[model samples]
Target: MPDTRYTFLDTPIGALLLAGADERLRCIGFPTGKGAVTPRADWHRDDAAFAEARRQLSAYFEGRLTRFDLDLDPRGTPFQRAVWEELTCIPPGETISYGALARRIGRPSASRAVGAANGANPLPIVVPCHRVIGAAGSLTGFAGGLDTKKWLLALERGATSRVSEQLSLL
Candidate 1:
């Protein structure tokens, strides 16, 4: 697509690369660890393009905002999109297993597929994929790393300052 814009926003976790085209947020990339995303050669850097997202993300990191209100345009398959949509419905401070997530999407037999979709989520925090955990309620792998996931869950559970303190050292 033409006119794809990007900008980096500093957060407690790290610098998140926000990128998309035509005012729609397509991807939110972590700065370090497993899911780091670099800018494309053809993409243009424009902070103003993602100002709203930057503001919302800042509020989220500070525990001032729970649900995001931005125009999201995450790209994925039809099933993945369904899984991601259900992910948004999961309340904050709560965890759901991959099997339960699959059940929520009416594909109860696709727990593994659900996990794969969760792993492929382009927007991590905003999309709430981190809320999905193992069957026994153990923390699972995260695109932004396990520590970031722990902080995110903790922030949702009213440990705002604790999360801030822990992540600020990063």
Candidate 2:
């Protein structure tokens, strides 16, 4: 199966699942659907990528960086990969509707399909699934839940200082 090894990182938002194979990161997502950070039990214990991830995440949470420069290996079909590739082009702090994203990928009629790919994104914050909102500008489905989506949006909007208080409910 996926040769991915993983680790958990405690962040201002919550626990982040960092998965990589060798030097290439595969995914980064919320752990346990909760904001509580915890350690991962099984993974490549000494992976260098994990160390780099910790640094990058620290910079991100501190608002020192706006975009990530990490290698990604999200598992999916060709079509889904295409959709995700487009998702990555969406700049930080900016958002697009699912329909808009589908249009960007030249699949204008595949808005719902785009949503599926967004939901299936193994890398959330890094790949920026949070940038895709409902057509009506509503925060929609997120594997980490709506509150996390809200928090991410706020963080991108220069509200990192409030993340600790916002995440306390989770």
Q: Candidate 1, residues 1-170: lDDT per residue as tens digits? A: 55889999998778999999887899999998878999999899998887888999999888899999999899999999999999999999899999999998899999999999999999999999989999998998899988888988998998858766866688
lDDT of 2: 0.78
Model 1 lDDT on a 0 to 1 scale: 0.91
Clashes of each: 0, 0
Which parts of model 1 are misplaced by more than 4 Å? Answer: 163-170
The TM-scores of all predictions, comma-separated, are 0.94, 0.85
Q: What clash pairs does model 1 have?
A: none
Query: Which ranges in model 2 have alpha carbons more than 4 Å from their true place?
Result: 1-3, 34-44, 47-49, 162-170
Question: Tens digit of lDDT per residue, candidate 2, span 83-149?
Answer: 8888789888889999999999999999999999988887788888888999999888887888778
Superposed Cα RMSD, model 1: 1.7
